[model samples]
Structure formats: structure tokens, C-alpha cells
Target: MVRGKTEMKRIENTTSRQVTFSKRRGGLLKKAFELSVLCDAEVALIIFSSKGKLYEFSNSSINKTIERYQRSVNEMGIGQKTTSQDNLQHLKEEANYMSEKIELLEASKRRLLGDSLESYTIDELQEVENQLEQSLSKIRATKTQLFKERIRQLKEEEKILAIENAKLREKWDEMQSTQKEIVEVETELFIGLPQPRTTR
Candidate 1:
């Protein structure tokens, strides 16, 4: 049978808790060392115990690493240093470019939505009107073509219906003539027959 899972509450026994902390701390440090070795990375770790004791570990001398960190920070201008002026200039230029792009996109959107055309200069308005007129003319031409095609189809359908109606009328006339001939034959046969014996 499988064992039951444990709850997430802290361990209440001091000895057990201490042992767990020691084991986990060793494991964590070992993993950190392995990561640094495998990835060629510099690693530093600091720890404080409940007794107010301090401990530190570094892949290299602590002083050298700290000096390097300080130099990098100086170059980055983190403490009133003006070393990053070039980077600031580049960022300002990039911001200006982005602002211009945004303005262009907004203007395009406004044009697409037909907003504020009256604010444009007369020359700009004339250009826009010319484009619109061209588009409208194209649309009208397409619509006229479609309407002509539809009318042509309707005319053809009407012609077909008229032909079918003529054929039906011809058939009806033939049927009526046949019926009239049968009636005439029956009348002749009755007249030619000896007159039926007088009723007495």
C-alpha cells in the first residue's frame, strides 16, 4: 500500500527541523556550485544564522567581484555618474522615431475613418476628392455591368417561357380538333341508323 501524503504545516520538533534545514542547505549550495561550474558563471552566496552569525561564499575573491560590480555601476551612472550619456542619446533618438511612427499610424487611421477631412488644406482636400471620385467611378462602372448582365439573363428567360407557351397552345389546339372530329362521327352514325321503331 502507498503511504499517505504529508501536510504542509511546519515541523514542530526542533531537532527534526534543524536536521532538515542542514540537509536542504547543503543540497542547495551543492546545486549552486554545480550550476556555476557547468555554465562558467560567477556565483556568490550569503547566509545568516539565527545566532546572528554571517557566512559568505564566492567563486572568486569577494573584493575583486565587488570592485567589478562597482565599476559597472559607475559606468551605468547609477550614482550621479554621467557615463551613460551616449546610451541616453540613443534612447532619445529611438523615442523620437517611435513618436513619429505613432503619429503617422494615427493619421492613417483618421483618414480611413473619414474623420476631420475639413481640417485639411484646400490642396490636400482636392487630392483626396480626386481619389474618391476615381473610386466611385470604378464602382459605378462595375454596377452598370452587373445590371446589364442581369437584364440580359431575364430577357433570355422570358424568351424561353414564350416559346414553351406557344408549344402548349399548339398541343391544346390539336387536342380540341381531335375531340370535334369524334363528335361529328358519332352524329353521322346516329343519323344513318334506321330510325328507331316508332314508339308504338
Candidate 2:
């Protein structure tokens, strides 16, 4: 049978917990040594027992390896700070671009609405007039489309109403024929004899 995965929590029993730590520590040290030899790499391992006993392993001097690690970490911090400054600069530039674009659009809108025309040249005024004419054309086209759609909807409604009226007229004719038959029977009963059939 396959072994189940061990839970990643503290071993509750004191003796079992201690034994597990000792076994894992030894295995870790052995693995570190093998990795250093196989890869010809600078490897290090450090461990402290629960009772404050120290254990360590290193392919080079442990103090020297630790110093090198510290210097590398400091250099990484500097690089990250520089990257952060670059990101800040990029965001500032993007904000400036958006601000300029917004100002341009606002200016265009003011010109379209005839709010600020004192600074415009004759050519610019002509351009604005052309833009307004194009805008009006588009608006008229949209209005025409809506009118056509409404007409189509009304025609469809009219057809449906005509069908309903025809049905009502047919039902009325049926009822009138039934009433005529009933009246003829009543008249015959009142006369106490059947009348000769005649077209009504």
C-alpha cells in the first residue's frame, strides 16, 4: 500500500517530535554535502536544536559565505529602489499625457459649442463649421432611422388590429344568426302554428 502524506503540523508526542527533528536534521546535512560535491557549488547549512545546540555545514568558511550573502542582499535592495524610481517616472509621464489629452478635448468641446471663438483663426472657424455640419447630418440620419422603425411597428400593430376586428365581426354575425332562429321559434309558439318559410 502507498504511504499517506504526513500532516504538516507539530508532532504532539515529545519523544516522537525530538526523534523526527534529529532524523530530518541529519538528512538535511547529508543532502547539503552531496549537493555541494555534485554541483561543485558553494553550499551552506545551519541548524539550532530546541535546546540551543548549534550545528552547521559549509563548503567554504561559514562566516565568509554569510558576509557574501549579506552584500548580495544589499545590492538587490539598491536595484529594487532604482526600479521603483523608474516606475514612478513612467507613471508621472503617463499622467502628464492624459492631462494634456483632456485639455485638448475640452478645448475642442468649447469650440464646438461656440464658447471660445475669439482666439480662433478664419481657417479654424471654417473647420469647426464643417465639423458641425457633419455632426448635424449624422443626427438627422439617426432621427430618420428611428422614424422608419416607428412606422414599421405601427403598421404591424394595424395589421394585428384588423385581424382582431375581423374575428369579432365573425362572432357577431354568428350571434345574430342564432338570435334570428330563436325569434322565429318564439313567434311560431305565440301564433300556436308554424308560419310559412320566408326570406328574412
Candidate 3:
């Protein structure tokens, strides 16, 4: 009698999980080796254990195989890939589109700079003029914003300086009053002194 298929789930027991991992890893490596030998094909396999231990198999250098795979995937797009000839044609079309875009941009730049306008239709010239006007408006708005910010900063600084100046003036006035009081006391003491009696 055929045995039922094992229901795959996470092995809850730690010991069982390690044992399963070891068995499966060996089985997988064996299959990979067998496939490479039987088919005479390049093969690379990499597996990482739960503890991050690396298990790998390669018929040839794994790096070379990885590079070859990457080149194949990129040069011919994945999933029922087109031929190299098709890829070349697609690239040629893309290049042509890019060249056209570059040419258009150069023409627009020339028109914007007031260098070449003879070939442009009226509509094209109008479009270029609109772009220039929008750019100028944005620049003017930015300049105004910067000036306002500067004015705000300067006002803030002026107010701070004004408050500091007021504090210094109050200190100076207090010092002056103290000096005047000291001088007045000294003057009173000098004037209130008694004269010594003269002998004949």
C-alpha cells in the first residue's frame, strides 16, 4: 500500500528540527550533485541553516555561475525570455526615442536662450515663452520670500539689541547716581570741619 504524503509543517521540537534539517540538507545536496552529473550541466545551490550556517554545492565556481545567470536574466528578460536579437531591437528603439528627446530638449533650450527660433512654429514658440515666464515668476517669488525672511531676521536682531541697550543704559544711570551720592557725602564732611584756634 502507498503511504500518504507527509503533511509539511514547522517541526516544533528543537531536536527534531535539527535532525530534519540535517537530513534534508544532505538529500538536497545529493539531488543537486546527481542532476549536475547526469545532465552534464552547471549547477549552483546555496542553503542557510536556522543558525545561519551555510551549505552550498556547485559543479563549477559558484561566482561564475551566478554571474552567468545574472547576465542571462538581464540581457534576456525573465519568464519566457525574448531572444538577444529581440533585445537588441528593443534597445535600438529605446535609443532612438532618447535621441529624439535630446534633440527636442536642445531645440527648446535654443529657443529659450533666444538663439534659434527660425524653425519653430508659432505654437512651439508660444510654449517656450510660457515656460520662460513661469520660470521668471517663480524666481521673483523666491527672491521676495528671501527678502522678507531677511527683513524679519534683521528686525528680530534690532529688537534684541534695543533691549540690551536699554539694560546697559539703566546700569549706567544707577552707577552715576551712586557716584553723585558718594561725592555729596564727601563734600558735606569737608565743609562741616571746625577751624583750629590761632595763638597770639
Q: Give the TM-score of candidate 3.
A: 0.49
Displacement of residue 12 (Cα, Å) in model 1 is: 97
lDDT of 2 by residue, 48-83 (tens): 998999999999999978996786688788874446
In candidate 1, which residue pairs clash?
A: none
lDDT of 3 by residue, 56-82 (tens): 999999998999789778866756666
Order candidates by lDDT, high to low.
2, 3, 1
- Per-candidate local distance difference test: 0.81, 0.92, 0.91
Model 1: lDDT of residue 51: 61
Which has the better TM-score: candidate 1, or candidate 2? Answer: 2
Could you tell me the lDDT of residue 61 within candidate 3?
96
Give every collision pair in model 3. none
Question: Which candidate number would show the highest lDDT if scored against the true structure?
Answer: 2
Best by TM-score: 2
